[model samples]
Target: MIGYVTIGVSDMARAKAFYSDLLADLDARVLMDLDRIAFFGQSMGKPMLAVCTPYDKQPNHPGNGNMVAINPGSKELVDKLYHKAIELGATCDGEPGQRIPDRFYGAYIRDLDGNKVAFFHFG
Candidate 1:
C-alpha cells in the first residue's frame, strides 16, 4: 500500500507556496517541514503528499505517466480545487467534468514542477 507520494521540484520555495495554497482547500496542512522536503495531509493516517529537491542531487524531472490523485470531498470541491490550482499558476490538463454520468467527476492539472495532480469525487 502507498503511505505517501513525493514529487521532485527544482524550486523548493515555489513548490511549497504552490502546494500550500492548493492543498488548503482539502484541509491538508504541513505535517513535516525540512530543508529539502515538506509533507502535506489532513492526518497521519491519510496518505501524505510531499515536494522535495532530488535526493540524487540532479535536476528534478517529472515521470511521464505518473500522477498523484487527490479527493476533494465533493463535485463542487473538485471544481474549486482545480480552478485554484490554475489560479496558483498550475497548467490545466483537463477541465472539471463527469467521467461517468452520476458516478465520477474529476479534473487534472500540472503542478508548478510539472507533476500531474488530479482532483476528483465519486457519487
Candidate 2:
C-alpha cells in the first residue's frame, strides 16, 4: 500500500504555495510541515503527497519516468485540476481527454520542479 510520495523541490516556499493552491481543489491541505518537508492530503488515512529538499542536501532533480497520479473521481474534475495546475505554472505533459476509450480519462503535467503528475478518472 502507498502512504505517500515525495517530490524533491528547489524552493520550499514556492513548492508549498504552489501545492497549497493547486491541491485545495481536491480538499487537500498541509497535513504535516517540517523544516525540510511538507505533506499534503485530506487526511493521513489516505495517500498523501509531499515536497522536500533532498535529504542528502544535493540539488533536487526529477526522476525520469516517475510520476504521481491523483484520481479526482470524474472526467470534469480531471479537466478542472489539469487547468488549475497549468494556471499555477505547471507545464502540460498531456491535455485532458479520454486516454482509453470508454474507460479512462486523464491529464498530465510537469510541476514547477518538473515532477510529473496525473489527474485521472477510471471507470
Candidate 3:
C-alpha cells in the first residue's frame, strides 16, 4: 500500500552516506540520486526511503510523531540493524527487545537527520 517515505534532511551528503552504509546489509542501494533528492531501496517497485531538501527552499525539520518502520524479516536482523544504526551515529530511541511477547520484536533509532526509524519483526 505504501510506495515510499520522504524525509527532509539538512545535509544531503551526510544523510546519503549514513543511509547508504546503514541499509547496505538489506541490499538497498542508491536507486536514484538527484540534485536535491535521493531514493534508496533494493529495487524499483518495492517500498523505498527518500531523503531531500525541503521543496520550499526553507530549512528542513523532521515532523513530530512521524516515523518510518522497516521489517528486517527476523528478530535477529532487527538487532543487527539496530546496532549498525548506532555505529553509524544514530541515537537509540528504543533498545532491541521483544515488545510483544511471542509476537513482535523491535528496535528504534533516530537517524543522523533525527528521523525516527524502526526496525522490527512481526510474526
Candidate 4:
C-alpha cells in the first residue's frame, strides 16, 4: 500500500483553500497545513491525501483520470464536504445527494487541478 496521494495543483494557496474546505469534514485534525503542501489524513492512520503545489502544469490540468474518493462515513459528512467545496470556489460535478447509477450516494467536486474527488457514504 502507498503512504499518501500527492495531487498536483497550480497554486498552493488555491489548493489549500479548496482542500481546506473539502477536508473540513475532519476539521484541522486531519489537514495539517505546511509550506507547499496540504496534508490530509484519517485519524489513527497515515497521511491519506497530499494536495501538492504544482510545478510545470497548467492551472487546472490533472495528469490522472483517477480520483480520490473520500469515505465520509455518513450522509452528514458527505453533505459537509460537498457544500464546503462549493463554498470555497470548487466547481460542482455531482451535487450533494445520492446517485443510483454507481451505487454512490455521494457528491463529486473538482478541485483546483480539475481532479474529481468524490465524497461518499456508500449506503
Candidate 5:
C-alpha cells in the first residue's frame, strides 16, 4: 500500500545514530540517504523506514512523536532487539511479548529523541 514512512527529528546526527543501531539490530541496511535517511531490511521486499528533520517549531516535544515498527527474524532475535534498544539508550515502551490476546509478540521502544519504535516476531 505504501513505500516508506518518513518522520521528523530535531537532530539528524542523533537520529542517524539511533536508527543505525536500531536497524542493524534488525539486520537492516543503510540503502540510501538524502534530505531523509532510508533503511533497508534483509528481505528485499520489505518497506524501508525513512527519517527526516522536523519542520514544526515547538518549545516542548513528546516521546518519539511517531512509531516505526520492524520485524525480527525470530522470537529470540526479538528478545535480543528489545533489550538491546535499552542498552543503546532507547527507552523500552513495551517489553517483548504477546501485545494482544495471543496475537502480537513485539517490543515497543523510544529512540534517543523520544520517537517510538517497535520490533516484533509472530512466532
Candidate 6:
C-alpha cells in the first residue's frame, strides 16, 4: 500500500504550474502546500502526489526507472489526460492506446521535471 508519491524538482514554480493544470483533469486540488513541497489529491487517504525540492539542498534529477501512474478511471479520460500533458509541454513517452488488447489502455509522458508519468484505465 502506497500512501503518497513524491518527485524532486529544481524549479518549484514551474513544476507547480505544470502539475496544477495537469492534475486538474482528475479534479485533484492542492491538499497541502509548504515552502518546498506541494501535495495534490482528490480526497483524504487516497494516494497523494507531491512535488518538491530535495531536502538535502542538492540539484534534482529524474530517476531512470521510476514512474508515477495515474488512473483517471476510463479510457476516454486517459486519452484526455495524455493530450492535456502534451498541450502543457510534456514530452510523450507513449501515445494513448490499448496496451494489451482490452485489458489495459494507457498513455505516458515525461513531466516538466522529466519524471515519467502514466495515465491509464483498465477494463
Considering every candidate listed, which one attains the maximal TM-score? 2
Q: Can you tell me which runs of candidate 5 are displaced by over 4 Å?
A: 35-45, 55-66
Residue 26 of model 2 has an lDDT of 88
Candidates sorted on lDDT, descending: 2, 3, 1, 6, 4, 5
lDDT of 2 by residue, 76-110 (tens): 99999999999999999999998899899999999
Per-residue C-alpha lDDT of model 3 across residues 84-105, encoded as one tens digit per residue: 9999999999999999999999
Clashing residue pairs in candidate 3 are: none
Q: For residues 8-79, what per-residue lDDT tens digits would candidate 6 score against the true structure?
A: 998888888899899897889788889799998887688999999999999988999999999999999999
lDDT of each: 0.92, 0.95, 0.94, 0.73, 0.71, 0.92
TM-scores of the models, in the given order? 0.95, 0.97, 0.97, 0.76, 0.77, 0.96
Per-residue C-alpha lDDT of model 1 across residues 6-70, encoded as one tens digit per residue: 99999989998889888887788888899899998988888999899999899999999999999
Better of 1 and 3 by lDDT: 3
As for candidate 1, its clashing pairs are none
lDDT, residue 14, model 2: 96
The order of the candidates by TM-score, greatest first, is 2, 3, 6, 1, 5, 4
Off by over 4 Å in 1: none
Model 4 — which ten-residue stretch has the worst lDDT?
22-31
Which model is ahead, 1 or 2, in terms of lDDT?
Answer: 2
Clashes per model (N, Cα, C within 3 A): 0, 0, 0, 0, 4, 0
lDDT of 5 by residue, 71-97 (tens): 776778888887878988889788888
Q: Tens digit of lDDT per residue, candidate 4, span 1-123?
A: 767787877787777766656666674344466776667776436647887766555454665677888887888888887888887777898887768765668888887668888888875
For residue 103, give model 1's deviation from the true position in Å: 1.8
State model 1's lDDT. Answer: 0.92
